[model samples]
Target: MDDLFRGKHHVKVDGKGRVSVPPGFRRALEAADPNCGPERNATVYIAHWDGEPFLTCMTVRGMQEMTEQVRAMHPGDPDREALEEFLYENVEELRLDDTHRITMPKHLRDAAGLEGEMIFGGRGDRFRIYSPDVPKPAVSRLAQQMSTRPAGTSPFALLPDRPRPPAPGPRPGE
Candidate 1:
């Protein structure tokens, strides 16, 4: 969840609602690890859009893994078919043009109501597209939300301490 993109770039949406995916962000997608091969191709998954008036782009890897896991749980059940369709249908396969711009299709643009000014933020393995017209909540307000958690709210914190819990001790019968 902490996969927030560190690179920031300001860009505008054209009259057609198409916005360029800054080269820096494209590079961010190409290299999941900062120090890796210079591959340029990246898999992109355009979700239906979420989080109050914003569109979210998830890494193709993230989307595939999530879909596969969910599908596996249901076996041959038809219930998962709908989810599979939803993910694939909404996902927009993307590519960088000669100018290194990742085009946003008209349908997606319309879905998110993007017009002129927009904000792009790296969201872990994917990215988020937001209309600049919308006002974002102040960081201080977010900090306050984080500060109000219950004391033992964490699962890991509730686990009993195993004071050295008997070592391997020669596996069963040494």
Candidate 2:
């Protein structure tokens, strides 16, 4: 299985609102966008939903997938409109610079209460940026719950199985 983004990084936000993306996370972003290169910087969509204490950053691919899922809903559905307003209307597409840094928009920074220090945490196809002052009790709870899982049992074992390739036979010479 493809290993999506995974890690936690602490970065400093300069007075200009610029923050450097962690090297590993930068690589993950690049990998998520095949078209990204030295000449073309990868773009991330930031969304600060109502009542959320952090900003969610998603790769272009993730954003496209979310958009597609949203489009699949009925055009006149209230839920669809609310989702669009919350996700699409509130999102800001920011392009990484050559130094793998981006200037967090004023609105987002203010909404997330980001100051000198911020936390960037990877979450598979997306990531979240939180203020240093955010609480860690939820993280602790999740770790506690995960530790209770029975040994040799995968958390995903209950999920439907995906198709796998057939085993290859030995060569004729062998």
Candidate 3:
């Protein structure tokens, strides 16, 4: 399976508005952006949803893909401008320092209501940092569903496993 951002981590927000990125997440970011190394800082784009108490973060490559999608829209389309404004105006580029942490800007911290502690949940190519008060029933529900799937029907069944043949059954005249 491809390397994916997947996990839930709790991190403390310091008085200075800095939060350390989980180590595993740092590795994932490095994997997503191969150009990043010890000397080169990895870039992350953060966007806070209006009226929502969370901030979505993605690698520079992911943000570039989103920008390309918006650029594909017709120039005269009104929605295109709105999307461009919403994305370009609200997004902030954060560079992970040597300590693997970034200072959250005041606007983003206020939008997400971040304070003492926050939850960082990975979602495929992106991740979200949410206040501790945010409800997480959806994640639990997904876990339940995955656990209940019948054998051999898991989405990950294509991964390498012990080879098996079809069960034999009576055929022809019996």
Which candidate wins on lDDT? 2
Candidate 1, residue 118: Cα displacement in angstroms equals 1.3
lDDT of 2 by residue, 33-98 (tens): 767886899888898886778888888788888899999999999999998997868999898998
What's model 1's lDDT at 35?
Answer: 27
lDDT of 1 at 104: 79
Q: List the residue pairs that clash in candidate 3.
A: none
Number of the top candidate by TM-score?
2
TM-score of candidate 1 versus the correct structure, residues matched by position: 0.63
Q: Which residue pairs in candidate 2 have backbone atoms (N, alpha carbon, C) closer than 3 angstroms, thus clashing? A: none
Q: Sum up the clashes in candidate 3.
A: 0
lDDT of each: 0.62, 0.82, 0.81
Candidate 1: where are CA atoms >4 Å away? 1-4, 32-40, 50-52, 76-82, 137-174
Better of 1 and 2 by lDDT: 2
How much does each candidate deviate from the true structure in C-alpha RMSD?
Answer: 7.1, 5.6, 5.7
At residue 111, what lDDT does model 3 achieve?
A: 89
How far does residue 40 in candidate 2 sit from its true spot (Å)?
1.0
